[model samples]
Target: MTLDPEDEKILTLARSARARNGTAEGAAVRDETGRTYVATDVNLPSLRLTAVQVAVATAVSSGAQGLEAAALVSDAEEPAQEDLAAVEDLGNAILFHAGLDGSLKGRYV
Candidate 1:
C-alpha cells in the first residue's frame, strides 16, 4: 500500500474508534495472488498506530506475517454486548465473516 499521509489519518481515525470501543482488531489479508487488503472486524483489538503506519512499517521491516502479526480484539460474531454479557461465561466462541462466496469463514485473524 502506498499509505499516503491522508491514508494514515484515516487509519488513525479507525484506530481511535476501535480503541474507544475496545471492540475490534484490524488487519489485512493476502489471497493466493498475493493481493492484500484490510478488513476491520468489530471484535478485534485496536491498533495503537494507524493502519497505514503499521502497514508501511511492516512492509519496510522484516516483512509481515500477515494477519498472524496483528492483534485480535473481538470475535466475528461479535454478539451484542448485552446479549453475550447477560448469558455470562459463554464457552470458547468463534466469529465468522460472510464472504462473497456465501461462506462463513475467518476472513481476518
Candidate 2:
C-alpha cells in the first residue's frame, strides 16, 4: 500500500535503526507536533522493551501529548500487545507494520 510521505519517512527511520543496531525490531513514532522518535528493541539484562514501546516512551518523555503515526519494522507477523497498548495510551495514531525489506505488511489504527 502506498503511504503518505511522512509515514514513509518513519518507516525508513525504523528500518535503518534495525539495520544499524542489529536488533530484532525497530520503530519510529511521529508526535502530534510532527516530531519523530526512533528506537530499537531494548534488551538489557535488567530491562526488556519492544522497539515500539521505547519509541512511544521517548515521544512521551519528550513532551509529545499524542502521536500522529507509528512505524514498526519487524519480522513478526503482528506487533506485541504491550507495544499496541503504548501507542493506544497516547491516542488513535495509525500504526504501520513493515517487513525487513521495507514492504508494507499491515496497518492498525
lDDT of 1 at 94: 22
> Model 1: runs farther than 4 Å from truth?
26-109
Candidate 1 per-residue lDDT over residues 1-109, each given as its tens digit: 2333433433344344345544344433222223333434432266344332333244334343332122222334432333222122222222222222222333222
lDDT of each: 0.33, 0.96
Residue lDDT tens for model 2, 57-90 = 9999999999999999999998889888999999
Pairs in clash, predicted candidate 1: 24-44, 24-45, 25-44, 25-45, 43-73, 43-74, 44-73, 44-74, 45-73
Q: Where is the poorest 10-residue window by lDDT in model 2?
A: 78-87
Clashes of each: 9, 0
Index of the highest-lDDT prediction: 2
TM-score of 1: 0.24
Error of 1 at 19 (Å): 0.4
Q: Top model by TM-score, which number? A: 2
